[model samples]
Structures are given as C-alpha cells and as structure tokens.
Target: MAAGSRRVRAARRRQRRLAKGTHDLTEVQWTALLSAWAGCAYCGAEDPSLQRDCVLPISRGGRYTLDNVVPACRSCNASKCNFEVTGWLRRKQLDEQDFLLRYAEIRATLVTDLDDLDDPRN
Candidate 1:
C-alpha cells in the first residue's frame, strides 16, 4: 500500500477507536507488556522493534487497551493485519492454545499490578 493510503487508513482506524470509547494504552503498560512478552506473541521472534497489535483488530471494534493489545514482530503484525488472533495463528501454524494461555496469564498479572498502583497502600 502507498504511504498516503496507509496514513489515511490509520487515521480512520483512530477515528473508529475513538468512536468505540477505547482506552489508551499507556506507555508504562506498554513497557510492562513488552517486557512480559519479550518477543513476538505469535511466533516468539525476539525482534527489537516490536509493534503493538490488536487481537480483535480496530476494524472489528477492538481497542488499543492492554486487554486487546500484544507485542508482535513487524512480520507477524503485518501478516495478521485485521485477522482474528486464533484463526491467524492457526493459518500461520503457530500454537494458538499457548498464545491464549500466556496472554491470559500476562494480562492478569499486569492488571493486578495496575490495580496495586491505584491503591493508596502501594
């Protein structure tokens, strides 16, 4: 796709996300997420430049929040563009079950950490 086309698509995606009232994924959360994953969430590639990929996709009303986002290498992120996570994983011959399980565990831990940060005692 042309650069202009990509920019336009990204702008539209941002509009859609705003319409859905999706929460922003903060830098702190993103850092923790990347640290937790430590590689491509799909293929386990230890790429230094990981991108934030939406599991459900913005086209499907997916948010940019922690629950919907994960670290993905550029290749996997581009290949899985706008596709459902499990189906894309299946097509790529990756372990869908493992991804789901790990995602759940990581999300839970991150959420708990966030909650603790919100607590006064913390």
Candidate 2:
C-alpha cells in the first residue's frame, strides 16, 4: 500500500474508534497502569517506551478505556495488530492465561483506586 493510503486508513480507523466510544483513559490512569504492570503487558519487557494498545482492538470495537487498554512494546503491538489477544498470545507461545489473570487483577486494583478518588470520604 502507498504511504498516502496507509495514512488515510489510519485516519479512518481513528474516526471509527471515536464513533464507537470515548477514549477516556487519562494520563494519570496511564501512569498508574504502567506502574502496576511494571513492563510490557504481553512480554514483560521492562522498556521505558511502551505504547498503549487496545486489548480488543479498535477495528474490533475496542476503545481506549482503562479496562480495554494495556502497555505494549512496539514489537508486540505491531505483531498483534487487529488480532484477538488469546490467539495472538498462543501463536507467539506466550501464556494467555497469565496475561489475562494479571490484567484482571491490575484493572480491578486501578478501578478501586479510581473509585476511592471519587468517594467523598477519600
């Protein structure tokens, strides 16, 4: 594909994601998420430059909310583009169950923290 076409496709994908839902993952939340994970969610690479990747993928109706996003290294993000998480992990010989379990635990903790922040008592 031509460079122009690729840009157009990316733009269209962005529009589609926006239409589907809000990208409400805040910077503070992102920081907490990164700290919780301590590395790439998929490969556990302790790289400083991690990208926010959608668990379900934008093309497949995923949004950038905290529940659907994780920190991924560039290589894993590129390799897993638009592919379902479990299947992609299996193909790469990674532990899908581990990722899922860890993700659930981290998400729960972060959500609880967020809720506490919203509470008047906090």
Candidate 3:
C-alpha cells in the first residue's frame, strides 16, 4: 500500500475502535459530571435527566475521552444525537459564538490527562 493509503487504513481502524459505546465513565469523566453540578453544560439547565454527551458524535470518529464530552440534559442530548456541537447549536437557533465560548469554559474546568478513547473499565 502507498504511504497515504496506509495512513487512511489506520485512521479507519481507529475510528471503528472508537465508535462503540463504552458505557463506562473514567475518573476524569466523573469529575466533569460532578463539576457540571448535574446541570446541562450547553444550556445550564439543572436537570436530573442529564447525560454525558459526546461533543463530537461517535459516528464522526469522535473519541470517548474527557475533552470530547460534556454534561447535557436529556432533551438536549437526545436532540443533538450525532450532530456536531456547533451545528446542533445552530440548528437549535442558539448563538454559536456564545455556545462555543461556554463550551470552552466548561472544557477548561474539566481538563484531564486521561486520553484513552476506549472504555477504561474494559
């Protein structure tokens, strides 16, 4: 295979590996969840039905890592299924710039050294 082809294959393999749902939260993820104060990271809604959502959907090769996730309410999370963060915000008629800024702030508070994409519990 050509060098470029090799790289593409490797990337595909990685994406396939990361597409599965781990259903396990790392310590870092736990910290992010707690730090969100059980509220939606996107809208600041204090919802008991909150869920950890992938900012970049898994189908798009988004890794299930600390940096790629945020706490979101069930409504927002379900509505955002497989949608890119910015796109979802736009579709919801939200201010993209403001949402991105808030996302940045939320991410900053939940930064972690753990970079594993697969479930750690596995």
Candidate 4:
C-alpha cells in the first residue's frame, strides 16, 4: 500500500483504540515506561522488549483495559507468564518489599508514568 494509505490506516486504528477505551502504546511510551522503571521491576537493568508485561495479567482474565497492562521488559513478562499478579511476582522470588514497589504499588504511579509523556518538561 501507499505511504499515505498506511498513515490513514494507522490513524483509524488509533481512533478505534481510543474509542475502545485504550491508548495504543507508541515506541515512545514503551521507552518511557522502561526508562522510568530504570530497567526491570524484578531486576534493575536494560531489559528486552520481546514480550510485554502486564501490571495485571489477563489469565486472571482481565480486560484489555488501561488499568491492567504494563510495558514489561521481556524477561519480566516471561517470568510473569499467565498467572495472577501476585502469583507471578512470587514465582520470580520477588519479596513483598520489592514486589510492592512495582507500578501497581501506587495508583499514582500509573497516572504519573502515562501523564509525563504529554507533559512539557522545562
């Protein structure tokens, strides 16, 4: 397809996602999430993006809902697999002290992480 056609198609997808109650993650959002986390939620380092990690996974059976997804670096996502948040967290041997520090730990973290992208920093 033509470049203009692709752009239009992409725009329609964005509009659809917006109407469906989710904001699509651009590469920038993924980058911001990783940078803000400063590496792994499990282990702090530059993490692979092979798979996305969810703050809340779906096989606890969640909606594609905004309150649930997180941009997990690959290994963390793999560690998480398909279990409930706490279950996967435990499997990775993350203690409550550290596990409790994940984005889900504070509702405000969610707001801050996402909102920062659109905010103008001086």
lDDT (10s digit) by residue, model 3, range 63-83: 666667777888889999888
Candidate 3 residue pairs in backbone clash: none
Instruction: Give the 10-residue window scoring lowest on summed lDDT in candidate 4.
Output: 57-66
lDDT (Cα, tens digit) per residue for candidate 1, span 44-118 = 999999999999888888888989999999999999988988999999899999999999999999999987987
1-122 per-residue lDDT for model 4 (tens digits): 69999989977865664465544556655555555566666555465553456565443444343455555666667767667777666667777466565665543565676777678892
Among all candidates shown, the one with the greatest lDDT: 2
Off by over 4 Å in 4: 1-23, 48-50, 63-67, 71-73, 104-110, 113-122
TM-score of each: 0.86, 0.91, 0.63, 0.54
lDDT score for residue 14 of model 3: 60
Model 4 TM-score, 2 decimals: 0.54
* Model 3 worst lDDT window (10 residues): 110-119
lDDT, residue 62, candidate 3 = 69
Order the candidates by TM-score, highest first: 2, 1, 3, 4
Off-target runs (Cα >4 Å) in candidate 1 are 1-14, 17-20
- Residue 51, candidate 1: Cα error in Å is 0.5
Error of 4 at 98 (Å): 2.0
Note the Cα lDDT for every prediction shown.
Answer: 0.91, 0.94, 0.72, 0.60
